[model samples]
Target: MPAPSFMGIYPADSVQEVHSSLPLDPLGPGAADLLAGDVEFRLHYLLQEAKKFMVHGKRTTLMPEDIEHAMEALNIEPVIVPPRPLPQAPFLAVPVPSGTSGAQQQLYTVVDDEIDFATYLKEPLPPALANSAGVKWKAHWLAVEGVQPAIPENPAPSSRAGPSRLPAPTTGAASLRPSAKQHLTTELQLYFSRLTAALIPTLAQLPNLPGNSTPSAPQYSFPDAERHRLAALASVRSDAAVAGILAYLVRWVAESINKTLMGATGTIGCLVDVVEAILDNDVLFVEPYLHQFLGPLLSILLTVPLGPHPPPSGMTPTTIELRTRAADVLAKLVTLYANGYPGLVPRLLSTFKKALTSSPFPSPLGSDYPPAGRYEGAVLGIGACGAHAVREAIWGTNGDGLRSINDLIGLLYPGEGRRNKAPLVRATMRALQQLTTPKPEGATVPPPDSAEVAEVFGPHFVRAFEKRPWQAQELMRLRKGSNGDAAAVQADAAGEEDEEMEEVQA
Candidate 1:
């Protein structure tokens, strides 16, 4: 498939059939007209497919076939588009010569400044974002700025109260403002609480799928519950809901890490605990009710700092705890990702880096898998955040570092003098396994060929999976365990064998 000379722009749905090219062309002429003419047809197809992208600023990549399909959809022939290889923009796009002239630096800075200024000026955020509970999660920051925090007050503030006596306006309102810690707490609390309620329908739908079926194979059920979780998370701005969600995620991580079977029961328990904690309360999660709340809590911690913005100062303690808890949490998340949640590793790495190097948090202990005791916990959480970017080559968001992670996992496991923290390693491995395997009951399994997969798993994924012949074999075994009919047949075979033995005895 030939790459388009220019970036393409089509009505988002126009690119539904696009697999390997830029979905929308920005540099081409008459792009808007092209979109307008084919808008209805493209929209019709998109709606039929229930395609969801773009709402997240996702650029749709297309392939030759996708471009052809899109052109055909519009009753136009696919153009024999020639590849005009424009210099691919560098990730950081530094100038070739270091210490360029002041004029050059100013020119570069002006461009950046203009882009930021325009983005800042764009008002009234996407409705999906604005309507999300995330607004409440970080609303506490509003308190820091001395603004009336945005939140759904438990008693619901009365509209009849006229504006209170006003103070003179501050210039800070003109710029990007930092939110207060207390307000962040209140907002996050309210947001997750609401998310818990919203996920009920999806949660109710999980028990319906045959528990033992490969997601790719024909299945009697779909993961409505998992879908709800993803959708609920998606509905939020990545940053806004992160803090609140992290609060719950850590608990899930802690529980699963400590579990025995390290399978559905433990994983599901963690998920349930997380969902319930967010839904059921407005307070600190501590035991009986707390019983291994750390997993979900840690998950939240690892994610929030890596979210759209940095955590508020108040949430620094939470961030610190996660950093203390990170070596283990990170190892577990990586394993979980390897097992099935491979897509999540990239996200986790991003968060982990943020928590390690960012403004507020301290660095992690030198080694991975810090000690599990309380005092060790105190120093474990330091300096884990800062904007240390992973080398894009080593770990592209597309699951590139699996082999490295696999090595790391080995180091974390029992023996190797790291056995004292074996539980963390075990739980981390279980999480990885769960992530790599097909999601269990009610888990939403994304389409292997979907854009989401492509972004995380890379374009040539099936081939990549085939490359790891041994891992592929294990995946096959896991698939059988997850298959309903196969298990039934195995059960029947065992029963028949038992009966024949009985007959021989008689």
Candidate 2:
């Protein structure tokens, strides 16, 4: 069937336009037999056309006779037009069987109702994406060069023969050639590092760009680095190469989280997709390499939900597995520290305590640490993940993780580290605060504002915080007749003693 050109026509006016725009042979070949002259046939055609008008371009209002005659002319013996084009029919997208391969491979299928923009960005990285680095980078370069400020070459000299009066070649093509050729390899390395640093954090956040909320690929106007990366990604034959790229991407996501860079949050979804793709494709999941990616992945998974947005949509079985695997890895990491990585638990908790209590700093001003703009979500995510690990270590399987959590909280929040400029610290502390607040007997104290982080740790967080030293300090401060009472008494006595001594000296 011919694809309909009905889009862009509004329902209110399309009916009128449909009548005027009817095909030349509305009654088709059959109209010629019924009409005596061309004039009669044309009138009949117009009349038939008027009868076969559309509402909203999708729903046809053809009478029974019009349909019968039209079908006969077209040699469609049995015309089967539905009463209405039921919206539920999945015509726009076709699902591919799991075993499909080669050029027939389908990239994705949205089995659910509507795919959200963030979810599109978050969907499993296609196996095809595993090695598209070169293409991505080249496309980026092409787009950049397309917009490259056209260097006005010295208008082909006024006099061709004599020594040209052109100005000395200071820059542009003339000056760029030697360094360009020589630094080709080195420049790429440096550029990739810089690009990764600047771009990866923002990649996660880029999907959420305001106003342009629609989801589509060719994510942005392609850049040189993107084109190059994509092309490189496509060139690799072995799954190892793909895994390596994904592993690096995971590292980038983790580092971006650590550095508290902008857009780091969006990267979590992207990394999730990549990991999902690896699993879906049955590509060798390199344990050690993926291990590095796990921390950031878990951090992001734990963090982004604390923000206003929900996690990306379209949870594939592969994605669920990846997330489950990440959780498992996190449990193991915590266990490793619980068992022997002696200082890990304390360090993790220390980081969380510091992030929670620290004063808020805007992203740009705090760019050296994790910035607020992009890094906030990822930082929160990481902090939340770390908090979960701390809680799990302390309370889950054994009681050993408690002291470590206490030491971490004490050290990080200790006189001043708590006030560090990291946003993640602040966000996590916010989580910890909610976790520690007392419930009214049966009333739930309510989960922290950062719900995703809370979810990662479950109910154990409140239980664990109840025993921490910070809780004791806060309780003591709040208690009417605790040590706080003794401190007040001591101050009053000291003040009286000083006053009496001063009067005696006088």
For model 2, residues 251-311, the per-residue Cα lDDT tens digits are 4445544443122233333344334444433455434344465566545433422221222
Residue by residue across 76-100, what tens digits does model 1's lDDT show?
Answer: 3332443444335434433454364
Q: What C-alpha root-mean-square deviation, in Å, does candidate 1 show against the real structure? A: 25.3
The Cα local distance difference test for each model comes to: 0.37, 0.40
lDDT of 1: 0.37
Among these predictions, the greatest TM-score belongs to 2
| lDDT value, candidate 2, whole model | 0.40
Q: Can you give the lDDT of residue 428 in candidate 2?
A: 37
The candidate that wins on lDDT is 2
Q: Model 2 residue 446 lDDT?
A: 34
Model 2 misplaced regions, further than 4 Å: 1-260, 263-268, 272-287, 294-343, 356-506
